[model samples]
Target: MFVDIHCHLDAVKNASEKIALAEKENVSLIVSNSVDIKSMEKNISLSKRFPIVKVALGIHPSEALSMNEKEIEKAFSFMEKNLKKAIAVGETGLDFKHAVTEKRRELQRELFKRHISLALEFNKPVIVHSRNARKECINILSEMNAEKVLLHWFLGSKKLLFEAIENDWLYSIGPSVFENPAVQKFALLSPLKNMALETDSPVLFNGKPAEPQWIPRIAKKIAKLKKTPLKKVETVTTNNAFRLLGLQQKG
Candidate 1:
């Protein structure tokens, strides 16, 4: 069974229907990730309501400006209260393109640090959202010793990619690899064991739409690009997802 390591399934109004489709296709599991506290609560509720779905909770960098110590504390408190019900801590990282002011950057960095701290404290994997801030993100994560980091939809610099590999962190490739040169390079250089695939569904792709089912399509393209067998690619990626999230691979 294929496992989508990162997807905002809970945010989709028809999430149940989409999940049912995944079940029919033998994609039995998906890690439903949330952007902020409210979304995290929704994701957790959805997971409790649906066994096939699991959750990752964190504040996204785009929404970092709104976060403060109180909010961070509340999020931590909620996470501790529902530790068993969640899987990871993220969708968090730096987004310099979106953060225009110096103050915003400071807040973003602080928020990122707090998220990393929470991840380490909870012993959960982190789904990072980095954009135009590769160097800063890498340095912060490295300093914090983020053991299980998932760099989602990474379009970062080559130097950062090497650092991630050096640190044994997992990089998740999305549909962008089909068109983005940097993503293609990552797929070409990274082996099946180090690569994970995501859809980041409900997000547009080439002016068109994307879905969780698109994960296997991304995997197929990656397999073809790497000249590996589909079965091998699927096996390694699925194994990585299960291992990183501490979930047993189920049929």
Candidate 2:
């Protein structure tokens, strides 16, 4: 069995069909992260209906940049009220490369801090969405003393990554591992115990769109990169996902 620690289930063309495809590959746990309140609500309903669906609530930096103060606050309030059964506080963090304004950058930083604060308060793992803002995000996270951190599809330099490893933060391998040399290298650098798997569905894989079912293939690639057995890759990554999400009930 495999675990997809990050994916936007609501972004897929047909969530039900894709989920069924994942089931055939034994992709058991799907952590569906939200970009906004609507996405959060959709994932919440999905979790109630699908045993494999686990929800993580947060706002994407890009979306936050475009959101007005009122919209951001309302979405945050909604998240706080509905965070009871959330698996993590994530898909949240800084992205310095996006088309955000100088003023928006400050707002995004404050909002992202709120997410870190919420995660710390709830004792939940944070699935971060970092980009060129690695230094800033890491500095803030370190300052706040987050309990558990999962840097999703990390694009930081090897130096920043070492800092993350020193903190024992987790990394989620997305499907890009096959085609992206950087991602492949990250898989090799990351210990099996410190890595989880994800598809980031709706994103392209080769020429086609990715889905949770692609996790097994992604795991196989990681296995190849690490020169380890596929079963070991599957086992370790799944265990990492479970530990990061605080879902102690193992599969």
Candidate 3:
């Protein structure tokens, strides 16, 4: 069975149908991450309704840029109250691509730190989104001494990637791997034990929204890049997902 370690199930159109399709494709678990308070609540409800759905509650960096202090606090409060329901703390990290101003960057960093702290407090892995700010994100994560880290759709410099690998962080390979040679290179460079699969559903890929059912295809791509057996890729990545997210595998 496969596991989608990161996705936005609440944002997907016809979410129920897509989830059923994923199940038919042997996707046993989908860790849906929240980008805002509303998504957090929706994902929580989705998890209760579907056994395969799990949640990771946090504020996205881009979302944080627009939120006022009061709103940010509200999100943090909600996450703390519902942290027990989340398998991880994420969709959180630095996104300098959108955080244009220095002040905005600082805000993102502070919020990211708080999310990491909360994850540590609860002993949950952190699924991060570090776009155009990989260095700062990695530095902050290292400063926090975070042990369980998953860099979702990671695209960093080779030196930084090596640093993360040295830290033993897991990277989630998404469907874009099929089209993006950089992503394919990432898959090849990353050790099988340090890799997991994600769809990041609702994100566009080749002009279509990705879904959890794309996981097997992503795994196949990784297998081809790594020159490993398809079954081995599936087994290792699925095990990596369960281990990092603290989920129990079904027999």
Q: Using lDDT as the measure, which candidate wins?
A: 3
- Report the error of model 3 at residue 121, Å: 0.5
Candidate 2: tens digits of C-alpha lDDT, residues 115-148: 9999888888888887878788889999999859
What's the best-to-worst order under lDDT? 3, 2, 1
Model-by-model lDDT, in order?
0.82, 0.86, 0.92
Candidate order by TM-score, highest to lowest?
Answer: 3, 2, 1
Candidate 1 residue-wise lDDT, 1-251, digit = tens: 67778889866758888888777766767888887779888888888788888898888888756777798778767766775568888788999999989989988898889889888988998889888887888899998888899988876567777788788788888889888877888788876767788888768888765677777788889988999888888889888888888888654
What lDDT does candidate 2 reach at residue 181?
91
How many clashing pairs per prediction, in order? 0, 0, 0
TM-score of 1: 0.92
Q: Which residue pairs in model 2 clash with each other?
A: none
Q: How many backbone clashes does candidate 1 have?
A: 0
* Worst 10-residue lDDT window, candidate 2: 242-251
Candidate closest to the true structure, highest TM-score: 3
